[model samples]
Target chain A: DAMVIQNPRYQVTQFGKPVTLSCSQTLNHNVMYWYQQKSSQAPKLLFHYYDKDFNNEADTPDNFQSRRPNTSFCFLDIRSPGLGDAAMYLCATSRTARDEKLFFGSGTQLSVL
Target chain B: QQQVKQSPQSLIVQKGGISIINCAYENTAFDYFPWYQQFPGKGPALLIAIRPDVSEKKEGRFTISFNKSAKQFSLHIMDSQPGDSATYFCAPLSGSARQLTFGSGTQLTVLP
Candidate 1:
């Protein structure tokens, strides 16, 4: 089935260490997004790639960064992991930035120790 | 101020009963209202969505009642079952930004 996929479903990193979460899709969607969802909270958009155009949320911390080398792949890099950074990282895609619907991946659960 | 507000931070519903989740939003250039269901350790899945022009849209057991004038919308799950339990979020878009903003989220538990 063509779907969004995230690797390392569960990740553990030491405090202040760098970590990377990955996402890929077979959907061939041009818009890819990264969301951070904490316990009992809604998913928060960190940044997104609208066909190579990187749009970052104003509130997103500098520690969080994303890269989309191509249409099928995207990556989230944490410059320095913190306890507060531990959360489920979700990847989503849309055929176009204006489309109303989204396709999501299972998510990468990060644990900062 | 939160752009989108969803009610009943959490809910417990019996099997075969109706599960209703409500959300209200401040008017903007927003055009799409989407409801998502997320299971533990998983990403959210789009259950159903509605446009401001429509009052209601239904799919199978799920229904979205959108009141554009009142700036509110709701999700009604009919004949709820245990497998229907999940966290729901109402993320309305400002045409297309940051998902515009996300609702706090509601955790639903359907008892079997």
Candidate 2:
């Protein structure tokens, strides 16, 4: 099954510590996206990569960054974890920009203590 | 301003009843509307989608009724079951950016 996969389904990090979340896809899609979803709220788009071209959302915090070294792998790096940063991080992929359906990974539940 | 607004933060329906979730969007440029279903501790999955050009689209027991003039779209789950209990989200995708702006989401519980 061609699907999106995320590593470390549950992550625990100390305050102000740096952490990285990973996502890989067998779908080989060109566009990869990272979203932060808090409890009972909509998933907020952090950034996305269009085959190595990074596009960050205007309101995304400076502490959040993403990297897509190749077509299949993307990583989300948190420069400094905060208690407010505890949320589910979702990874999604799509083949094209125009009305294409997004495939999402199970997500990484980050806990900042 | 929130581009999309969803109604009824939560809903409870009996099994075999109808489940309806509604959403309204402020962006007139949005051409694509999609509904995603999310389970606890999991990512949202695309359940169904519709385009502004069409008034309605149906797949299996799920139906999306889109009112382009009103800038509102809704999802109707027919013959709801316990397995259908999950969070439902409605999103509208802007045509130019193809980026989706989602609603707050509605948690639906279907009692068996």
Candidate 3:
């Protein structure tokens, strides 16, 4: 089945330490996105890569960055993990920029101690 | 800015009952609206969706009612079961460059 996959289901990091979450997709979707979801809350868009063009949400802090090495893989990097940054980081991909149906990976649960 | 709002942050229903979730949106970027279901410790899965051109769409016990004029839509789950308990999110997509803008989410608990 064509699906999105994320590595390290649970990640623990010290405050101020940096961490990276990995994502890969077999769906070959051109648009990959990263979202932050806190407990019982909505998933907030952090940024996305539509092909090679990166689109970042205005309110997304400078601490979060993303890299799409190719069409099938994407990575999210936290320059400095903060306590408030502890949440589920979800990786999703759609067929195209106009495609709204997203396939999401099982997410990396980040814990910043 | 696009904002999706959902009501009833949490709901409790008995098996064989119907579960209803309402949503309203502001500044919708596209006509497509979808509901995602997420279980504990799992990624969200697409449950159902509707387009503005249609008033209602149904697959099995799940139904989606769309009201374009009111900028509102809803998901109706018939014959609610314990297995159906999960968090539901109302997300309208194509917003901010064709991405989903998800609502806060409603935790549904269906008791047997």
Q: What tens digits encode model 2's per-residue C-alpha lDDT throughout B1-112?
A: 9899998799999999999999988999888899999999989999999988899999999999998888899999999999999999997888788887889999999999
Per-residue lDDT for B6-101 in model 3, tens only?
Answer: 988999999999999999998656678999999997888899999888999999999999998899999999999999999999988765556777
The candidate 3 chain B region of ten consecutive residues with least summed lDDT is: B92-101
Which parts of model 1 are misplaced by more than 4 Å?
B96-100
Strongest candidate by DockQ? 3
DockQ of each: 0.76, 0.83, 0.84
The per-residue C-alpha lDDT of model 3 at residue B47 equals 95
Displacement of residue B77 (Cα, Å) in model 2 is 0.4
Docking class of 3: high
Q: Write the per-residue lDDT of candidate 1 for residues A57-112, one digit (tens) a residue.
A: 89999999888888899999999999999999999999987787888999999999
In DockQ, how does model 2 score against the reference complex? 0.83
| CA lDDT, candidate 2, residue B60 | 91
Residue B27's C-alpha lDDT in candidate 1?
Answer: 59
B73-106: candidate 1 lDDT, tens digit per residue: 9999999999999999898888635364679999
lDDT scores for all predictions?
0.90, 0.92, 0.91
Can you list the residue pairs that collide in candidate 1? B97-B100
Show pairs that collide, candidate 3: none
B-chain TM-scores per prediction: 0.95, 0.98, 0.95
Compared to the true structure, candidate 2 yields what TM-score?
Answer: 0.98
